[model samples]
Target: MAIVELLNQDMKQAMKARDKETLSVIRMVKASMQNEAIKLQKDALSEEEELTVLARELKQRKDSLHEFEEAGREDLVSKLNTEIEIIQAYMPEQLSDEELETIVVQTIEEVQAQSKKDMGKVMSALMPKVKGKAEGSRVNQLVQKNLS
Candidate 1:
């Protein structure tokens, strides 16, 4: 099923189960998706578009988690972690380190990225393939590791 359909179904399930946290997180995601769709002047988002929004939400949660931990805010960190888990459930499986390494190597070769100066070329070549499957920082680290 498309992401929107799946999210709708899961929302219903969360409501029925009285999963307050899950329901709230899913509702936030749905709202964000709808808001983005409106901003784009579209009736609905495509699956790829939905994934992009979801990815941004996940990244935001990750950044919050880091800040919460650094501030010694265990209560907020725990809450954020729960929300992160719920958000991630909607994302595609993350790429393994080995798989990411392989892709970075291939991208480097494809883009003829011989030095750090060609980082943009390698990143442009890799982003489409890695989108929704891996984090940008992970991809950048792998590319740097392979290129240097």
Candidate 2:
């Protein structure tokens, strides 16, 4: 099923199960997707576009999670963790380190990226292939490791 339909189905199940956290997270994601569609002036988002929205949402929560941890806000940290899990459930399966490294190396080769200076070229060629499957930072790190 398309992500939107899957989300709708999951939202109904969450409502039926009285899963407040899941329901809230689903609503938030749905709203984000809707907002993105409006911003693009599209009636619906393509699958890639949907993944972009999910990625943005996941990244925001993860960034917040890090800040909360640094601030020693345990309560908020736990809450954000839950939210992160909920958001991640809707994302594509993540790439393992080995797989991500392989792709990064291949992209670097494909782009003829010889050093960190070519990082932008490698990333531009790499991201679309690995989108929704790997975290951008992790990919960047792998690229750097292989480059230098």
Clash pairs, candidate 2, are: none
Model 2 segments more than 4 A misplaced: none
Q: Count backbone clashes in candidate 1.
A: 0
lDDT string, candidate 1, 61-124, tens digits: 9999999999999999999999999999999999999998988898898878899989999999
CA lDDT, candidate 1, residue 2: 88
TM for candidate 2 is 0.95
The C-alpha stretches of model 1 lying farther than 4 A from their native spots are: none
Summarize candidate 2's per-residue lDDT along 32-148 as a digit string, tens digits: 999999999999999999999999999999999999999999999999999999989889999999898888888888888888999999989999999999998898888889899
Residue 73 of model 1, lDDT score: 100
Reference-based lDDT, each prediction: 0.93, 0.93
Report the C-alpha displacement of residue 108, candidate 2, in angstroms. 1.5
